[model samples]
Target: MAVDLGQFDHPSWLTVAGTGLGYALILAVLTLTMFIVPWLVFSAL
Candidate 1:
């Protein structure tokens, strides 16, 4: 499910920017949680 913006030049970048940012944010949160949970559990012990 990729976005195809090859036809449009300027607007293509604009549309993808928001979606890219959102995807990046989600990835960051998931990655952080993976490490944080393990650290918290070990520290508690």
Candidate 2:
């Protein structure tokens, strides 16, 4: 499904940039979390 950017209030450029940054930050956090969780659980055992 496609979003209708023509109906939104935000400028297209800012929307694109913000979405990219948000995805990148989320990906980094998940990657770090996956690596740290295992070590933490093992250490507690």
Pick the TM-score winner. Answer: 2
In candidate 2, what are the lDDT values of residues 1-45, reduced to their tens digit?
989867766688788999999999999999879988888989999
Q: Where is model 1 poorest over a 10-residue stretch in terms of lDDT?
A: 5-14
**Model 2: how far is 22 from its true place, Å?**
0.2
| C-alpha RMSD of candidate 1 | 6.1
Query: Which stretches in model 1 have alpha-carbon errors above 4 Å?
Result: 1-9
Alpha-carbon RMSD, each predicted model: 6.1, 6.5
**Model 1 clashing residue pairs (backbone):** none
Q: How far is candidate 2 from the true structure (C-alpha RMSD, Å)?
A: 6.5
CA lDDT, candidate 2, residue 1: 100
Please give, for residues 13-35, the per-residue lDDT of candidate 1 as tens digits.
77799899999999989987999
